[model samples]
Target: MRLSRFVSAASAFLLTAALALTGSGPAHAAGPVYVALGDSYAAGVGSGSYDDSRGGCYRSLRAYPRLWANAHTPSGFSFTACSGADTTDVIKRQLGPLNASTTLVSITAGGNDAGFVGVMTTCLLNSSSACLRRIDRARDYIENRLPARLDALYDAIGSRAPAARVVVVGYPHFYKLGTSCIGLGASKRRAINDAADLLDTVTAKRAADHGFAFGDVRGTFAGHEICAGPAWLHNLTLPVYESYHPTASGQSGGYLPVFTAAV
Candidate 1:
């Protein structure tokens, strides 16, 4: 009788502990079906640990969507977000995994559509005037052309995953101004930051119009941008594609919390 009672007590304790962890820990039992969609930032280019099978998509294991999935253990997760994916790319290629069963979505795009690489290349390799001129042209595209594209992509997502809670994540300011920053000049840094702000504003508005949550990481990245000590974003790294994207810390410490709260 005593042996049976001890075994029962031990079993009850284990069950209670498991229940407590399930209730309070990061992992939830049979959580939402998540589909992550967007650009290099979403694919975790800068965060490294690339999944080679993804080819040039460069999806990283440390990316926020993956980290969130690792923690929450969603029933299903489709990470179709590709490196260098533009809005059109997303609409055409990335929407397949999303469906009526998907419960959560996150995306970061439009930078590529606005000639992110071109502008950055011009800025980093040329004079400040060159950078500003390209920025002006890009801003024109952002203000005039990107809206329709975003609408088209949003419509596609809605049609495919009508029940999903989409979170459109935006870019962060790349520099901390007013300090003597190496690499990029003050004007260049300011212009880059302004462009980031504009992109976020436009993206946020479109996401809001579609009744989606806009996860703005600008505020979260403040004081952690390049030129700030211990920056979460890389500054002109060797891989180059990794440059200007979030590090692993940013994915975990920056993007994850904002995404989690929104979800």
Candidate 2:
């Protein structure tokens, strides 16, 4: 009877150990399912080393989403963000990756919708007055038209990924003020920075209205703007397609830290 009892106890212990090793134990749980969505910044446009699989989207390994994923090791990760994507593109195309199973979502958008590229181009290639006019136009759009669009996007994100923590990341000022820089004057620099600030404000307010968290990255890129000694953002690139985007350092240093803190 004693021998029989000892054998049964040993068998039960072995079975429990096997279940633990196989990850079938009660303590075992799946990691978070993270989905990254937005535009070029979130896709790491100028960070270099694009994933060919994603094609024109220019999803880079050095991008913040990848960096965040590497550190966190979520059970599943879907990086659906593309280059040059606006809020409309996100609502139509990017939302496909998100679903009921998603637990986390990170997005950096609205700059494109506000015609930021046009503002930069006018400032860089045209007269100061022309730059101001373009800036004013963009700001008008941001104030008059962007709020409703942002509300729609935020609401859609919330509805689609009900359980996910949506983080709306904002853009940084391209130029540092009160500093000498080539190709752009101080006034132009200040105007562009002001526009960025306004964009962040609108984006943050929309996120809050939807009960989503906003990741403010303006302060993180403070000393590392285009005019910095060693700039974090690319002033220009050979392809020109990569211009004004974040460098690899910016992705790893500027964006990663702020995003990490928020998450």
Candidate 3:
């Protein structure tokens, strides 16, 4: 009887061990799963040395996501962010990588929906009055229509990855605090920066409403903007595809540190 009891006890211990190994025991048994989702900024558009496997997504090895992943070594990582992706694109294409298993998520979005590219182009190529009008239009859209869209997106993300710690990353102003060295008028420079600030403000509030952390990058890029002594952002690329995106140094130094601290 003693021997039989001992065998049964040993069998139970082995079964429990097997369950743990197979990740069927409890939450503690599962490994970390990280998912990155968003648009060009999240995809490292301006950072050189793109990953060919990701095609037009323009993901760079030196991007903040990869940097953070390298440092943490999560059990699984899915980087689905793509260049030129808007919020709608994220809802349709990017969210596929997230699920109940996701423990971490990072996103940089809403700029496209707010017509960031168009605003920048108008400001760069058009008259100051035209630029201000464009900026006002974008600002109105951000204040009036953006909040609801953001709320829905945040809700969708939360529902899909209920347990994940979501980090909403914000964009930086392109110019230094009071300097516009790229031939842009002072008012135009200030307008552009103010637009960026508004975007971040709206993004942060929406993130807070959903209980997600907003990773503000304005301070991170303070002295490294386009007009700075040693700029961290690309000025304007000939191909146009690489224009105005963060440099590799920006990703490694500016974004990585802020994201690391948030996560």
Report, for all candidates in order, the number of backbone clashes: 0, 0, 0
Cα displacement (Å) at residue 112, model 1: 0.3
RMSD of each: 6.4, 2.7, 3.8
lDDT of 1 by residue, 1-263 (tens): 99999999999999889988787536645679999999998999899899999779999999999999999989999999999899999988898888889989998889999999998999999998999999999999999999999999898998899999999988888899998778999999999889888888999999999999998887888899999978999999888779889999988888988888888
Least lDDT summed over 10 consecutive residues: which range in candidate 3? 23-32
Colliding residue pairs in candidate 2: none
lDDT ranking of the models: 1, 2, 3
Identify the runs in model 1 with alpha carbons over 4 angstroms from their true place: 1-29
Better of 1 and 2 by TM-score: 2
Rate residue 263 of model 3 by lDDT.
89
Error of 3 at 142 (Å): 0.8
State in Å the error of residue 30, model 2: 1.8
C-alpha lDDT of all candidate models, in order? 0.91, 0.90, 0.90
> How high a TM-score does candidate 2 get?
0.92
